[model samples]
Target: MKWSEFKIHTTNEAIEPVSNILHEAGASGVVIEDRNDLDKDWSTMYGTIYELDPENYPEEGVYIKAYLPVNSFLGETVEEIKQAINNLETFDIDIGHNKVTISEINEEEWATAWKKYYKPVKISDKITITPTWEDYQPVSSDEIIIELDPGMAFGTGTHPTTVLSLQALERYIQTGDSVMDVGSGSGVLSIGAILLGAADVQAFDLDEVAVKSTTINVKLNKVQDRVTTRQNDLLKDIDVQADVIVSNILAEIIVKTTQEAYQLIKPGGYFITSGIINAKKELVKQDLEKQGFNIVETNQMEDWISIIAQKPE
Candidate 1:
């Protein structure tokens, strides 16, 4: 089989939303090449190894690459992806150059080439994300290991937004508390919640692939019985209330669902949200506050932001 690789050049602020747009356009996975990553001090024993090729990286901004099978509708899919990316500017997101390129490759290369980019990453104080193909050992007695194989899915549980969300989960999850995971990609948060002693988790995603990926990942961590997966738009018509509600999606979606999230969480429960770029933090913060949630914590890593808010009892 043949596959088309679409490489999009855009600003750092546009990477997350553009990648999401590509995913929604039927791309299984995406590769991000941020020029800033080349400047990071990565030799400080961060417990994560990244093997990046300088040739493929952008000279400015970032490059996001995704693969789609060579089919009759391939051209239409690519055009739609471009249009969706252009729509980001309406949200005041800087898209930079927004240059797009395409190339064809064999399916075999697509299957194995991406593995080299993933490694054992210690994302937070107690949680470490390891790919299924890697041989990893627990370096600490209390360390929590999340084993995941994104397969054709987009998340590997190591993105800054994901890391911040997991770290927040670590700090707030209580033993036997119920968790509601909105946009639970790869089921990483649900698995993390269960590991952190949450009694049960209801995970939802609008994407069918994400729902399936979450189900498989929950079972991979041996928490299928504790975590339930389903396809649902964020917090619409959901009657079940949870001890804690978490979402790691775009700031636009997060803000739109803030009120519903507030209604779905138990009194005094917490709402943790990420996938917010640095510039949009204040907007989301104000939205959550307007919905009667008291902002408790704000976390930032790189260009991303995460907020933890509590519903007043």
Candidate 2:
């Protein structure tokens, strides 16, 4: 399968609007990369995705992204994609060199394509998640099935940090506990709680794509009635206290969010947080400790850590 990869370089402020324009013009999807720029806003550098057409497609886009089609199912060629970027130079957006690799696969090797990447994943042994396109068996002990088409948005549970959070959720969630999943990308953590025995789950994230993606996953898992989503800044103006709180945002945000997260969890409740890098872990741990949370456990995976701290009993 031949595919075109497009890379665009421009000022931080223009990324979203330009990505939006490209989506409107027609794009299969966009992958936003965090290219280091001192002048760049870290907030804006987080990337997103969109869909484009292969049939009767407009090979050119005003805010062009490279496009190449894979022969596996459907998608465009690298050359056709390059032309689109070459055309966008007038807007002063520089196209990066292609590092995309394409390969041809046997047309009927459907299982092989995904099988190489898909493995039996237990969000917990009871709450096993399998991609919808893959084949898997749910043993009698398995509680629910979550279907997802994984992408860059987050919460596929492939990451150890997310897995850490899920394992903690499985351990702590009571049968009727209410949970608030802050930064609920793909709603994976919150939905996992609900499936694990939480009575009701409310989740929020800063990204619209995350909110939409989480909502979709909630529905896909048939837990829509149990899980609700909203878009809001971290615990600002939210007054209801829950039995458990989960946040998987950056360590800085997590550190700053302690006061608010503390307020959102009832005295007996606990908070689960990830997205903490090793370098910043102590800083956040100190901040969380000061908020009167007793650090119950810390689990490390790769360079990431998941911390669970309980508000005083």
Candidate 3:
């Protein structure tokens, strides 16, 4: 159960592309964090700052963390990693030459140990995610339920991107609307979408944790019949059309997936996007406009923005 931790220092701009490449290359979990976060030690705490809720900050940048199985680098793994790291022309990057760390662990022991860092998270006024190990009482017997221990999946509903995405979901979900949550981490948005009123919700994430978390969360919320989590990217493999399409991911991925989001929507359907840095507002706006989505409104919390757009009739 040993893991190889690959820390790559890349220009803030190249973080997403690098993550995508590694993800395609079969990395387990990839995380991006600000350089300033490195100073914070979470050995006793969560070792990571800024929850993945996506509803907290406005804009930020940092280093990327990608973890791979130890066997992936049995021999010369460091060298292979270095070569992969150096090949990226998307941004500036640095390495300590021998800074790569490879360590073994008892998977169960490590997983259990990390669960201590998890706590219950409140995503919105009506939605609450409590880890199985914590004590929490729902505002209502059935208002919302997301029983999960945070691991490497997204959506404790703590990050600005996720928070904003869920907030946007609150405004538009109707009792019978078919909804799609692209990059649905931990199935938070999908779960929220279902709780909010959407009858049939379909979600997708590129990560296995996301897929697994979404399934686990659906059961936790008792919405298995309404919310369906799929393993797909954008709408590349999801064939169903939806009334609402939500994406809480980086701007570059947003741009790349814009068309698919548009296609997923029925005429005049809605598209809600968060996980956008304030600086990239225009880039997203332009992409939406080009694809015939009229920007209805944009909400910003801290430096992050969540925009709501409508597919034209």
Question: TM-score, each model?
Answer: 0.94, 0.66, 0.72
Estimate the overall C-alpha local distance difference test score of candidate 2: 0.64
How well is each residue in 1-313 modelled by candidate 3, as lDDT tens digits? 6765566655444544455555545555555544433433445432243344333212344445555666744456556655676665343232223133444545554445335435665556666667666777766765566665444455345555777787788777777899988887777788788878898888888777668878887887789998878788677866678999998887767898888788879998999998787888899999999988999989986567898999998
Error at 264, model 3, angstroms = 3.3
Compared with the true structure, all predictions reach lDDT values of 0.88, 0.64, 0.68
In candidate 1, stretches whose alpha carbon ends up further than 4 angstroms from where it belongs are: 43-45
Which structure among the candidates has the greatest lDDT?
A: 1
What TM-score number comes out for model 3? 0.72
Each prediction's number of clashing residue pairs: 0, 13, 19
Clash list (residue pairs), candidate 1:
none
In candidate 2, where is summed lDDT lowest over 10 consecutive residues?
45-54
73, model 3: CA deviation in Å? 3.7
How would you encode candidate 1's per-residue C-alpha lDDT over 189-268 as one tens digit per residue? 99999999999999999888788889888888899999989899988889989999999988888998999998989999
Task: Identify the superior model by TM-score, candidate 1 or candidate 2.
Answer: 1
For model 1, the run of ten residues with the poorest summed lDDT: 40-49
Candidate 3 RMSD computed on C-alpha atoms after optimal superposition onto the true structure: 6.2
